[model samples]
Target: MPAVSAVSAAPLPAPPRTLGTGLLLVVLVVAFEAMAVGTVLPRVASELQGLSLYGWASSAFLLSSLFGAVLGGVLSDRRGLAWGAGFSLAVFAAGLLVGGLAPTMLVFVLGRLIQGLGAGGLGALPFAVVTAHYPEAQRARMLAAVASAWLLPALVGPLVASLIADTWSWRAVFWGLVPLLALIAPLCLWPLRGPAPRVGEGSGGAGLLRPALGLALAAGALVEGLRSPGPLGAGLVGLGGAGVVLTARHLFPAGLLRFAGGLPTALAVRGLAAFALLGANSFLPLALHELRGLSLTAAGWVLSLGGATWTLGSWAQAQAERRWGPGSRPLRVRVGLGLMATGLLASALAVLGGLPLWAVYPSWVLACFGMGVGYNSNSLYALAAAPPGESGRLSGQLANIEVLMVAVAAGVGGALIARLPLERAFALAFAVTLLAAVLGWLAAGRLRRTS
Candidate 1:
């Protein structure tokens, strides 16, 4: 009886750390693909004589992502992280293949839509995986590592994509990623192999699919409406705006728009931050080149600096958590939002006020720093608060809000630029983004409330 007791009490094996690191690396690959695709998209449009449909390529991706995000969460909750993750990668690889071999612009856009689907799902799965697999103590560090992965892509993605487009062909860029993904797929899948752990109760995956598609359409219409010209555009915008409100109700947790406390507020804050930051980021290079008269190379370098500084900020949050603790989450969020507002406002002044070009540099660093801390921390808090079996849902909501905000920002920015003078347009965009940061700051308080 004593011997049997000792055998039963023996230590269980330690969970593999490779899973955490591999997931981060998978995010790295996704970031790189997104960054690289953006770099060469212009050439692809020109070569395929699809300048008219240029915006559609990206819009399609954004639209499809809505479905992907929700589906990923549902799948993860029902089947497990492995199934969701594997499917996303497979779909992503297929998109890359189709896009790479596409001979027409329409086909290319179709490929992008597929890619968006996969990328969206892939994006959500990482958070779900982290929540399901990682210990609370290591989650922040893992998130920090994920954030850091973006640094390399942001620094080199554009240059590499451009060089390949110039020296060889854009197809190579897409095809090139295939082999790399083949390698990454195995690393990611290696840890996922084994008996699947049920993340929730019985599978009800199909139930979420319909609403997800509706949400995707809503976002797509909004993007298209904003980009279109004249009364038609206005009509689409009106219709799409209505659809967004209606569809979002089903897509998000109840009371999200009303700022209901708990997961809803956290998700809302994330949406606001993304809206502010991505809106500003989309315009930063344009402002630098057009207003400041900097060369493209110079503008790229400035962006790179911001990306590098973002990594620093991510590392700082991890270090703070390691040294101090999680009790400071609210303070971190507040400070992050404050910095974001300050940086964007200062940048708006620099751009609109005609300050020296160099002024924009420090402003971007500050803004990126804020994003690094705020975004990662927001994810950590929201996921941490999520009820068991609902991590995937939280992840989906967070990603959905972010994707929607970014699309809205881009659409709004484009509309402004079309209507007003470049400088005024950019100034207004920056001002709007600053307001988003302020909103985020206000919303952060709700996170402390019990969900």
Candidate 2:
């Protein structure tokens, strides 16, 4: 005891409590908004007579978020995390206000676009914070904590939103959260104040921002084309597809589409997984409400169940990482992808093959749980591999890919839904998701770099 060194005797410093709390609160609020909106979207569409534009509600946000993610990343790298975070939070709040007061579907979509800008930044900043602030050992735990933030929101958000919508108005759901943002803003920003620690040479604005704008515009065009009918729609789709192809090369790491090893594969896996799970999830409430004849509250229960399992799965992966170490990531991702595919297949059968309606609950749970496991693991893998001073950029790229894929999936699904009967459209959507999951599972094997 007398020979003990002061350094050895001291316990490791924990991550800033206020900062972590603020970040988690941000995640909590964002997750709640997502769940609530999904639950109430049918109602919104019906009231606003926007069934044709149902997909735009989600796509617009995602597309605009593409720009936000890149801009936030650039600002975080150059100006500082606090500056980017403050700007993002403010934009997010403004979007909510606009959405709450929207007089028409067009106005509501405009609000969503604004929200995407802020939400995208908010989504990417946490990863940058984790990279800059936390030690390697604590990173996984932090990511898991972020996932855990979804727990309360998932458990109660949809149900509460449904109740609010029934008792008051869906508009309340958007307005209710704005004040909470005010409370959390200080907690998150205070710890991150001042100049960002010098890491490396910051990337320039134009190279990233230009592509981000192109990506968002391309995605928007694609969604609109999907919703449109006739040859004009086909032409728009082609144009959007070409634009995405050209712009994507500038935004993502090289060999992304081909699933090159390490970062590329990880990003691809995450994007495809999100496309499968979230794409299917977007249509789930609608399916339950329209095809299965469930009440909004009952449909919300299904989503809540999925959210609960998702949290459990995330924690389980974290525990596994603790026990087996980082080497287990590929296995975890592969296993999660398998479960997702299985769940999606089961969901499709339930919708089309005459399986009982209740089959969807367990199936969704499995799918979401897989997402919880794989999505977090993918983030860890990518962050661990990030070049010095590029965490913000990497995080933005990751968020961009996920957002883009989900937007496309949802937009395509909505287009189908508008064209086909409810049952067929939902079944086909599930099939698309299932295919994505299967492909992601195959790609999971490539997560590690080859010699």
- By TM-score, the best candidate is 1
> What residue pairs are clashing in model 2?
none
**144-189: candidate 1 lDDT, tens digit per residue:** 8887888999999988888998999999888778888888776677
Winning model by lDDT: 2
Clashes of each: 0, 0
Regions of candidate 2 where Cα sits further than 4 Å from its true position: 1-13, 39-55, 103-105, 165-170, 199-204, 288-296, 449-451
TM-score of each: 0.94, 0.90
lDDT tens digits by residue: candidate 2, 119-224: 9999898788887677766777889899889899878887789899999999989978999999999999998887774545545444789989998999888887
Deviation of model 2 at 375, angstroms: 1.4
Relative to the true structure, candidate 1 has a C-alpha RMSD (angstroms) of 5.3
295 Cα displacement, candidate 1 (Å) = 1.5
